[model samples]
Target: MPNCHCFWSHIWNISGGVGEMGANMNSIIEEERVRGGVFKDINPEDEDQQPTVIESLCMNCYENGSTRLLFTKIPFFKEIIISSFTCPHCNWTNTEIQSAGRIQEQGVLYTLQVKTKEDMNREVVKSDSASTRIPQLDFEIPAFTQKGSLSTIEGLLDRAVAGLEQDQPIRKATDPAVAEKIEEFIERLKKLKKVEEEFTLIIDDPSGNSFIENPSAPQKDTALTVTHYKRTPEHNAVLGIEEEEDDRKPVNDLDTMRNEVLVFNTNCPECNAPANTNMKLVQIPHFKEVIIMATNCDSCRHRTNEVKSGGATEELGTRITLHLTDPSDMSRDLLKSETCSVLIPELEFELGMAALGGKFTTLEGLLKDIKDLIVSKNPFMCGDSSTADRAGKLELFGQKIDKIIAGEMDVHVILDDPAGNSYLQNVYAPDPDPEMKIEKYTRTFEQNEDLGLNDMKTEGYAEK
Candidate 1:
């Protein structure tokens, strides 16, 4: 029998088996990223010493919020007009046909459609003429790209609030009518504050053919025209910064930083009454690297600090078996028949032969029989019917009758839930086995209540 055992092991050292350690390792990597918050892989300060011209990253520069300046030898009128700017961020393309005299005066049009990437695709001369034709040429420019904004803590919180509001239901969790009223209230609140910022580039094409070279000195060559546009935050809150506020915090003020530190009150082991404690001075096992500060209330002297972890298991340490079967009167013949191919939707199974005392010839044959049984019966069984139990025997049977035609077959499926602890195995399957014994621990019910001052709370939960 071929053995392919994939399990998660808490390795003391970094060296781990190829497939075995993958899932666990990924969890560790994700945890680090979250704790560190947003990180920039490239150093922004060291950009000056790097090469100025980049070919593959022309469109990418504008998309990433960087300005590109270009300079090239002109063919006509002391300076030739370039067609457009391609935004690497949003793929917005733009064109600015400047009269060499205008570019030197405006220092390159930072705003507007003609100078922006979008205007490049728009037709310039709305003419029914046969003589005028467009010209295309290449020019070189010095260009540089840099990230525009670094988000602050307040900005992150504001974004999180926006996200929360989107997922909020229109109706109350308990009362449908109340939920609708709350939703309406939220809509009104949105319109009143108008917290969201909008940015737009406007371009005017006079003669139509508007081509512009890079305006910034950094990227004069390849950073010429941007063809795409990316949505940018007009005002992003900078971290480690503070802003003046009114008596109450504004609804749309995502950039406002909070000055007060977060404080949590909990029961303390020694005394529970608003006492501050630090995690740095404690010693603990598996969670030594995790830092948590604890405090107690001044009145009760209760202390608590160990926050519960929230994530799916980094290591399931369990193996799940999936079985497929097919059975046809010409089963042996069908085994050789490659015409009908079985497709397991939403499932990928690892197959093996001789799992049960070598009862069947090929792995595929056994699976076909099982599938056949399933088709006949709404839910087929895995061979576990053993009266004189040595080990529960796997058994499956199927029957189908149409008019004078009758078809019947049997197949079996058996599995071991790693530690005999996976009680909710069927719930995890995309479409679980119907015959498998399962128990429910919760009943369905509903209720409605209202608190004064428009305060409300509603919840729903399920269990197996």
Candidate 2:
């Protein structure tokens, strides 16, 4: 058997030589190999040549060697080298692939729906830094933790099944019931590879080094959809490119305080006792806004917090309305600025900025929070006859909100923001629903005057 260290050194030298010589050397090698009748023709001379394979030592065993290194160029992608090692003496084998390319700025995601045998035969290139997920099965192979491989869809599923079978947690599970469930999942994956079922395969690569080929649509691979997205802070950390933490002194350092306590000796609204209030000015850099947060009543154990924005006032008023249909819409992101108001006409409830203050929550979360608040304040509605009628209405409203959240009832949500700092997220872009309306209208005379819009007019200006 060949020495494992010597074989790896040779492999490194070959890779380094290819890097130094460029495509010219690759062409020469391809010509030489073809003339020697080594490999079959894979592409035209204008395209990249077929892969070159070299024998190497079996790292697993020193007695028997059956290792090979295959270097190939992926069409429209970078050069990749695949290494496979098999030990006849120990019956052990391993395969891995590495890409020789610069990291991409934007990450890529490929979503493919596999429904036929041809789909299973499609080529898949997964980088070690990429993650794979099957949404239907709720199974995921996390990124930066798996080996890179050049395989088919069927091969990928087989690998997943093998991985699940070898999983230590599932094997040594304390609950036999959980182990049985895992075993059942493994069987399902095996059946999926056999084309007995359909599944969606999602590959997310932060490095943007992975790919899946579509034979039918060779040029563009229209069978699979590709989406590019900016890498998150966590991805930056994983890639070791995170920015250094700021070490400079903060503007509001406690040592150089104008006042030790901004609003101290204030009486608690709940207990009517002398309470200390601490005020801190915070800046939200992303939104380009400043906020003042005050926490009061540490002494009476009746704490209350308030947030006020110090940003520039908005001139144009905006209103947003959304008709809730799918329960999935409840997960949409929401940002309620300090000057925004939320209204649910179905529930006959309107919360002004002064009432609910500013908050960031999902639609369902906002509804549940409001329901809980109403319940807390109207405890007497459950027992007092004087408030019984109002309590019944409130209870009915709560039930309707619940039904809406569960996708059983349809309702409308409206947000009015004079400051134009509030936002309603649209789950589908470029195809937004007509029912979800966002209108910008002229503010009333009192609203314009309050915001100093009236003072900006010329002397002879008149209402349009």
Candidate 3:
């Protein structure tokens, strides 16, 4: 099996070996020079500092000789190395490209309309991980399926044709009807390469490592349309920067845990009516976090429920699990933060942070609130026959909640607070309570990132 170098050398050799290969390389260099060539010298005045060009054994023709490797940089794009090999014996030639910059945060896509022959001269930097496509031709070259190349629009099309030619088995196995279609498609691509047709070329790179030069476009705008998109979690995993779990304890001030104030008259922020506000400072056992619960209400029926943290930023998150075995458990105080995620595994119902605001209530009150919210406000799930099946499931969930509240069914309540500000009554509290489990675990990198704590810096700046 001949390597890429051998394959390329075979190509040049078949067209006439060293003499022809030299002329081809020279033609490329001339074309580059005519179009304001991108390669630059770090120290042009000193011959000693001339661009470093190294020779190494060609992976494709190791038995023959070495290839040439040139290190250079282009304006806007930095630190790129080009590798080329031309075996004298086998007349095999090949070229490859690589970027020496740091990985990007998001992927990039470049779409260009090939309207003229000049467009074919536009430089393109395609990383090995990028995919190329010609939408008009219904053709695609998947990422990591082809060698990275520093080439022009024509070069890209040529590569595509080469790839198709290499897939002989697929073409041969195709039905007679489709085989002609394939041939026509290949011929159309060849014509496009020769600037005989206009088409659209799109390059999608999840690594944000590819480029399509637009030298003629204005400084603010380019002929190419560039689109950036967030990489999926799976893509991030491959980049070796997968978020780690946050594993730090909350900063709880035990000395501040004193319940002295009862209630204060205030104006409701919602209706600006006279209201009474109740406040309580309670300690979260084992988790070392303090929850400040506030409840406000007025005669106008305007109500407010909020929970604030009395401790420093916590490194680890908190999770509370409660088993409602008796009706008495319904009366237990529950301080849920706006950031807390509530789940009832037995009932197969869960409420995310976006579902509702924070609340200072009991387990039964929380369930009742959820039930009302789903039954009335969530018409998207209950109003139409399109969701008739889900409506039935929701009804069943409401019934389960009723049974649990009536102490007729056993159900488990779980609250996960990545902010570590939520609270649930502990079994070992100063006052005797039913058996409930409270577990604290470190938050994952993704969780901390979501909370805007991953990039938090506490030092090097004065307090305002």
The number of the candidate with the highest TM-score is: 3
- Global CA lDDT of candidate 2, please? 0.68
lDDT of each: 0.28, 0.68, 0.69
What is the TM-score of each predicted model, taking all chains together?
Answer: 0.15, 0.43, 0.45
State the TM-score for model 1.
Answer: 0.15
Query: How many pairs of residues collide in each model?
Result: 85, 0, 10
Q: lDDT of model 3 at residue 391?
A: 79
For residues 114-222, what per-residue lDDT tens digits would candidate 1 score against the true structure?
2233323222211111011111111111111111111222222233346436646643555677767546655543432342322222222222223332333243323
By summed lDDT, the worst window of 10 consecutive residues in model 1 runs over 1-10
- Candidate order (lDDT): 3, 2, 1
What does the lDDT come to for candidate 1?
A: 0.28
Tens-place lDDT digits, model 3, residues 51-118: 22333444445544444434456445556656656666666766677775667878898889888888
How would you encode candidate 2's per-residue C-alpha lDDT over 157-218 as one tens digit per residue? 88887777776475556767777888898888888888787789999998888988766544
Better of 2 and 3 by lDDT: 3
